[model samples]
Target: MRTTDVVRAAGGCVVRVGAAGLEVLLLHRVSPDEWRLPKGRVRPGEEPETAALREVREEAGVLAEILCPLDETEHQFTDRADSQRRTKRTIYFLMRPLSSTTAPTDPDFDQAVWLSPAEALARLTFDTERHVVGVALRLLLGQD
Candidate 1:
């Protein structure tokens, strides 16, 4: 049997109460041409929580603080560069935005925008990320 590499990643659902009620920050990735949550690999010796906050700041060009642990998702895919099967386990945190800027610093993504929960759910390319954001919305709205 071929072994699949396991990768640890973390991300945040940066949300705030906007005029439209609840809004979520999403990144528009250029390479895949898809909308995604701001996330990345957890660095060596770094905690998942810290990685999530860092990724949100780096990718969204805004600062945020974790309010609570949202949820985790795992999925498998083939790496394009190496043609190797890999499983990515991502930890997600519910975060509150600390800044107003929405410019994305990461070159991999060209756009960062805040959308309503329903809109974000519709715009997200992956079901896992959409689930994560859904959980965050429930918690924020005191439904969870």
Candidate 2:
């Protein structure tokens, strides 16, 4: 039997009402060439909610306020650098953008774009994130 290292992380489904409808922000990683929601590991002494807002600011370069917590998702993967299996538990928040301009401060992501819920669901590389977006949509639409 093996014990898996669990990494605590957080992120946001930053959304707004646009012409096409609710739009979610998605980050395009440079190296991996994948579309994902802005997220990162929670630092020492940092709250998960704080980490989620910081990640959104750092990765998307957009200031946002949390409307509500959307979901907490866990997934297992092998870390590319360490080659060790790990489980990432990420808490996601539903956020509303405060600033319109996007100038990503994180070098890991080269592009940040707002996409409709359907588009975001199709573009997101991970199912966990897509599910988070769905949760956000439900909350915004008063369906939850």
Candidate 3:
């Protein structure tokens, strides 16, 4: 696959259940009024699952383990860095936090915070992302 023309990324609904219900980790963009799950471009020769795990760590400073495959969202857009038209396919996984320590480390986002699943679902900028989070929630409830 020519990565230049088609970019691949991976991310997921990293969650923790609490008294308030399920909470998902979301990263707020530095300038844009948008919040999204941790994600980044997949490196050459890197697996999507590996990329997902790395993105969570690098972007949110959250260590998590994938519970299952959730879904994939694909969209074509122009790359801001080079103005090249490209298609990005992002695969989402249902992940659970492995530890309580977390922080936002990536410079791309201003902050990362946990939000209630309902609020998070509503705050997602894209419908596809909201759907992915729903998928993860369904999977979690099903297993309970």
* Regions more than 4 Å wrong, model 3: 1-4
* Alpha-carbon lDDT of model 3: 0.87
Model 2 spans with C-alpha error above 4 angstroms: 1-4
**Residue by residue across 1-144, what tens digits does model 1's lDDT show?**
233388889999999889968789999999979999999999989999999999998998979999999899999888777998899889999898999778899999999999988899999999999899889877877897
Scored by CA lDDT, what does every candidate get? 0.90, 0.90, 0.87
lDDT by residue for model 3 (1-144), tens: 475688889997899986788889989987667788888888989999999999999988999999888998999899999998889999998899997767888877888888998889888898888988888888878953
**Using TM-score as the measure, which candidate wins?**
1
TM-score of 1: 0.93
TM-score of each: 0.93, 0.92, 0.92
lDDT of 1 at 74: 93
Candidate 1: stretches off by over 4 Å: 1-4
Cα shift from native, residue 78, model 3 (Å): 0.4
